[model samples]
Target: MPSETARELRRRLHQQQLISAFGREALRGAGLDGLLQDAARAASEGLDTDLAKVLQHLPGEQCLLIVAGVGWGPDVIGVVRFGTDLASPAGFALRTGAPVISNHLGGEGRFRTPQLMVEHGVRRAVNVLIRGEAGAPPFGVLEVDSRDAQEEFSESDVAFLQSLANVVGLAIDRDRDRRDRDLLTREAHHRVKNSLQIAQTLLRLQLREVEDPEAKRQLEQAARRIMTIGAVHERLFSGPAIGLVVVATYLRGLVEDLRASLGVGDGGRPLALEVTPASEEAVWDGDRVTTLGLVATELVTNAFKYGRGTVTLRFEIAALTGGGTLVVADEGDGPPPGFDQAKGGLGMRILTTLLRGGGLAAERPPEGGFRFVATLAPPPAGNGG
Candidate 1:
C-alpha cells in the first residue's frame, strides 16, 4: 500500500492540474466575473477549503469586491463588500507582493481579522497575490479559509493556493487584453466613419448650389457612392471585432438612408424599398460591405429611376457556393431593346468595373421584370463561419 504522504502528494498534484485546466477553458468563454467564480469553486473543492473567493480591487478604493466566491451564502458573494486594510492578510499579501498564511487565525497578532471573518468562525486562512507584471498593480487575491477553529494549513497548502491564484492571474490578463482590443476597434471605426460622414455632408451642401443638370447628376452619383463607403464603416463600427458582420442589420440602415434621400412629397410617390433578409448567420467583412453597397445602390437606384413600383432587395444563402447572393429586382420596363449598355455612362461603367472583381449577371425573366444578381465572394480569408 502507498504511504499516506505519497497519496496526499498525488492528490495535490491532481488539484493543480485541474485548476490550471479551468483557466484555459475560461479564457475561451465570456466575462471575467464568471471566470473568477469558477476558479474559486475549483480551489475550494480541490483543496478542501471551507471558503474560497476571488477578489477584485478597484483602482480608487481600499476595499475588494467579492466578484467570485464559493462557500459563502448567496447574500454575501456579490452583495457584501469588505475592506483590505493592511491589518488583514489579503491586504498584506497584496502590498508585499507575496502570499500570506495564518495557521491559527485568532492566535496570530500580526494582522487583525475583520469582524466578518470573526462572525463566520474562520480560524485559519491563506491568501496569495493574483500577481501581474512586475511593478504593476495586482489583479486581486485568491483566498482559502477554514471556518473551523481546529483546522490548520501547512506550507504546501499555501503553495497550492498560490498556484491557483496564478491561474486566475492568467485569466485576468487575457480578459483585459480582449477589452483593450475591443476599445481600439471601436475607436478606429468611429474616427474613419465620422470623417467620411463629414465629407459626405459637405458634398451634399455643395450639391445645393450646382445648377447644370449634367453636372448635378454627376455630383449626385459621387455623393451616393460616398454614402456606400460610409455605410461600410458604420456596419463595422456596430459589430464585433472578429470581422464577421451580420447582413440584415447592415443593409437595413442603407435602405433607410436611400429612402430619406428622396424628399417626401417632392418625389412622385413615397417609395417603399422593401428589404427581405434570409436571416442566415452569414458574415461579411468591410470590403464586401462597400462592394455590395455600391452594387445594390446602382441597381436599386436604377430601378426606382427608370423601372417602376416598389424596389425589393434580397440577401440569401447562395445555392452553389460558400457565399451569399444579393439580388435587386423591380417590376419595371426592361432595359431598352439592344440598349448600348457599354456606353451607359459613369454609373454603368462603375458597376461593370466593380463586378469584374465579384460575380454578376443580369436577366429580364420570361415572366417579366428586371433583376440584377451579384455573388458576394466568400468572406475574407479566415473571416467565415
Candidate 2:
C-alpha cells in the first residue's frame, strides 16, 4: 500500500501532467474564450479545488468580469463582480499581490458578505491575483473554492495557486499579442491597397497628357497592373490572415480585370485566359504577388496588343525540385524568331528588369508564341517553413 505522502506526490504529478496537456491543447484551440475556460478547469484540478473562477478586468466597464468559471451555478457565475472598493477581499488581493484566504468564509470579518458563499456551499476560499507586467494595472484575479469548511489550505497551496495564476496571465498575454498582430497586419494591407489605388489614378491622369500612343498604352497598362496588385491587398485586408494570399483566386480576378481593361467584349468572347495549377493551392507573400502581377500585366498587354489569337496563363508549383514556374503563353504568331526579350521595347525592358530584380529569369518559349516563364524563389527563413 502506498503511504499518504507517496499517494499525494503521485496525485500532484498527475495534476501537473494534466495542466501541461491542457496548455498545449489550448494553444491549438480556435478562440480565447475556449482557452480561458480550459485554463480555469485545469487550474481547478491542479489546485485540488471544487470550483475555480477567472475574472478579467474590463477597463471600459471599470469592473472585473467573470471570463471563465467551473463548478459554479450560472446565477452566481454571471451575477458577481469585483468593484473598485479596496476593502473588498478580491480587490485587496489584486492590489497587494497576495492570496486572500478564508478558512471559514462565514466567520471571516474581511470576507465580503459570506452569505453568498454560504448560499453556494463554498465554505473555504482562496483568491489569487494575476498582475500585469511592471507598473501596469492588474489584469485579473483567480478564485478557488472548497465545499468543506475544515479544508484549510496550506502555504504550498497558496504557492501552487500563484503558479497557476502566472500560467493564466502568460496565456492571456499571448492571445492578446496574437490578436494585436493580426489587426495591425490587416490595417497595413488596407493602407497599402489604398495607396496603390491613388498611385494608379495619378498614372492614368499623367497618361492623358502624353502624345506618344505607345507611351500612353504602357502607362495605362502600368495603372491596370497596379490595380491588380491592389486587388490582392484588398482581399487580404478583408480576411483574418494577411500574410498568405490565394494564388488561384487572385489570378482569376486579375484576368477578368485585364479582359475588361483591354476591351475584350462580353458574351464569352474575352481574351481566352486559362490558368493551370500544379497544385490545388499556391500561397505567396505580398512582394511575390506584386512581382507576379507586374509580369502578368506585361504578358496580357502584349497578347491583347499584338498576339494574333487567344491567350493562356498557366501557373505550376512543383515540390523540392527547386523553384516553381509561371508560364504565360499567347496563341498569336510567335515573337519574331530569335527576338531578344531583353532588347525589346521599353515595356519589355521594364518587365525584364522587374523579373531579374525578383531573382527570376524571363524568357520566350522556343517552340512558338510569346511565353514569359518566371521561376518562383524559395521563401525566406522563419516564414511558415
Candidate 3:
C-alpha cells in the first residue's frame, strides 16, 4: 500500500489537472450552463466527493437556485432553492464570501443542514463563493458534498474549489463582453447596409431619368458597386462569426442576386454563373471577402458584356500562404488580341483599382475561352476567421 503522503500528493495532482482542464473550457467561451455543469463535476471529482452543485443567487428573493449539479435526482436540480442567510451551510459562504467546511453537519450547531441534504444522508460539505464583476453581487456558491459520514475536507480542498469558482467568474465576464461587442457590431452593419440600400435606390431612380447612354451606364455600374457592398453587409449580419465570411455561401447569394437583375447572357441564353468549392465553408476576412466580391462583379460584368455563354468563377486558396487567386472565365472569345488590359474599359479600370493597383492576367485557355486571374494577398489571421 502507498504511504498516506504519496496518496495525498497524487490527489493534489489530480485536482490540479481538473482545474486546468476546466479553465481551458471556460476560456473557450463555452455556454454558461455548460460551464456551470463542468465546474460542478470538476469540483466533485477533485474533492473525491459524491455530490456537487452550482447554486445561482437570486438577489431579490435572497435565495439560491440549483442551476447545475451532479449526483442529484431529476426532481432536485433546477427545482430546489436554498435561503442565502448565515444559518444555511452554502449560504454562509455566499453571504460572507468565505470558504465553508462542515465535516460533521449532523452534529454541527453553527449552520442548519438543508432538508434535502438531511434526506440524502449527506454528512459533510464544502462551500466556496463564485464572485462576479467588482461591486456586482456574488454569482452564488459552489458546493461539494459527501454522503460518507467519515469523509473529511481540508484547506487544500477549499483552495482547489475556490480556483474553479474563479474560472467560472472569469468566463461569465468574458461571455458578457463578447455578447456586448457582437450587439454593437451587428447594429453598425445594419446601419451601413441601410444607408447603402438608400443610395442604390436613388441611383436606380436617376438611371431611369438619364437619356445619355454613357452617363446611364456609369450610374448603373456605381449602383451595382454599392449593391455589392450592401450584399456583403447582409452576409456578415447573418453569418455566425462577426468578421469572417464564408466565401462559397456569400458568392452564391451574390451571383443569384446579379442574375436576377442582369437577365440573360449572350444569344439571349439564361445568365449562368458557376462558383467552385461548392462547400458552404472556406472562411476569410470580411473586408477581403468584400473586395473579392466586387472584383468578381466587375469581371462577371465584363464577361457578360463582351464574352458569351456561362460565366465560371473559381477561387483557389494557396495552402502554404493562405493567399489565393480568383479566376473568372467565359466561353466567349476574350478581348481582341494585342488589347492592353491596363487601358481597357471602365470595368477593367475598376478591377485594378479595387485590387489596390494590382493588375489581372488575361489568358486564352486551350479549351477556347477567356480567363482573367486576380491574385489576392493572404487574409489576416484571427478575428474569428
Candidate 4:
C-alpha cells in the first residue's frame, strides 16, 4: 500500500480536477441565477460538505450577499447578507485574500459566527475569498462545512476549498464581460433608433414642401427606406445575437412593412408582395446587413412602383464565401441597361461596388419584367454565427 502522504497528494490532485470541471459547467447558463446555483452545487459536492454559500461582495453597501447556497433554507439563499468587518474571520479572510477556518463555533473566541450559522448548527467550516482577474477585486466568498459537531477541517481541506473558490472567480469574470457587452449593445441600439427617427422626421418635413405630386411621392419613398433600416435595428436589439444578424428574418419583416407602406399602385390597385427563401438562415454583421437592407428597399420599392402583378423577393446562400444573395424581381418591365451606371447616388454606389468583383449582380432577366439580384459581400457572421 502507498504511504499516507502519497494518498493525501493523490486526493488533492483529484479534487483540483473536480473543481475545474464543475467550474466550467456552472458558468454555462443563460443568466446569473443559473450560474450561481451551478457554482454552489460544485463547491458543496467537491468539498463533501453539508453546506456551501457563494457570496458576492457589495462594495457600496460594505457587505456580502449570499447569491447562491446549498443546504440552506430557500429564503436565505439570496436574503442573507454579511458585514465586511476586518475583525470577523469571514470578512478578514476576504480582505486578506486568504482562507479562515473555525474548528468549532461553540468554543471559538477569535472570530464571531453569524446568527444564521449558529441556528443551522454549522460547527466547523472554512471560508475562502473568491477572487476575479489579476487587476480586479474579489468576486465573493465560498464557505463550506460539515453539519456534525465532531467534524474537523484539515489544512489540505482548506486548500481544496480555496481552489474551488478560485475556479468560481474565473466564472464571475466571464459573466461580467457578458454583462458589459450587453449594456453597450443596448445603448447603441437606443442611439441608432433615435437617429433614424430624426432622419424620418426630416424627410417628412421636406415632403410637405414639394410642388409636384411625383416629387412628393419620391420623398415619401425615401422616408420609408429609412424606416426599413430602422426596423432592422429593432430586430437586432430584440435577439440574443451580440454581433451578427439573421438576414432571412430581417427581410421577412421588411417585406411586410414595404407592402403596407405602398398600399395601392397605379390606379389604386391592391399591391401584393411575396418572399421565397431557401429555408436556411444567413448571418451578417451591421455594415453588410445595412448595405443589403438598403439594396432590398431600393429594388422592392422600384418593383412596386413600376411593375404589375405580384412582387416577389428571392434569397439564396453561398456557403463558399459565407455570404448570401438576394433577388428582388417582378413581372413588370425592368430598369434600362444603363440604369446601374447612370445613377451614382448612395444606393446605386452600393450596387456598383458589389457588381465589380462579382460580389453582387443586377440584371433584367429576359423572361419577364425587371429584377435586381445582388450578391452580397462576404460579411462577418453576426451573433447568430
Model number with the top lDDT: 3
RMSD (Å) per prediction: 2.6, 3.8, 3.4, 4.1
Q: Which tens-of-lDDT digit does each residue in 165-230 have in candidate 2? A: 776667667777788898888788889988999999899789879999878877887788788788
Local accuracy of candidate 3 as per-residue lDDT tens digits, 1-385: 6799899999999999999999889877789999999999999999987699999999898899999999999999899999988999888998889899999998999999999999988999999999979987788999999998775899999999999999999887887788999999989989999999999999999999999998987898788889888999888855657877778778887787777556653456444445445334567767878888899888877887788877887777666666667888989999888899788877887787777734489999997988899987765664335
- Model 1 ranges off by over 4 Å: 27-30, 240-244, 264-277, 319-322, 339-344
List the candidate numbers ranked by TM-score, top first.
1, 3, 2, 4
Best-matching candidate per TM-score:
1
* lDDT score for residue 41 of model 4: 74
What lDDT does candidate 2 reach at residue 112? 67
Residue 319: error of model 3 in Å? 3.8
Q: What TM-score do all the candidates reach, one by one?
A: 0.90, 0.83, 0.85, 0.79
Q: Per-model C-alpha lDDT, please?
A: 0.75, 0.71, 0.85, 0.74
Question: Candidate 4 lDDT, tens digit per residue, 1-385?
Answer: 6698897777777778877777667556446666667667766776677698888889999998888889998889888998889756678788888798888877788778888888887887788888889989888888886677775777887777777777677777878988899899878987897899899989889877888998888788788878877887777764447656777777777777776677653564444434445424666666666777777787777677767766777777677766667787777776555665446455566567644444545576768666777776554455234
Which regions of candidate 4 fall more than 4 Å away from where they truly are? 1-3, 22-35, 59-63, 73-75, 83-89, 95-98, 133-137, 148-151, 212-222, 260-283, 316-322, 335-349, 354-370, 377-385
Q: Score candidate 4 by lDDT.
A: 0.74
What's the true lDDT of residue 189 in model 3? 89
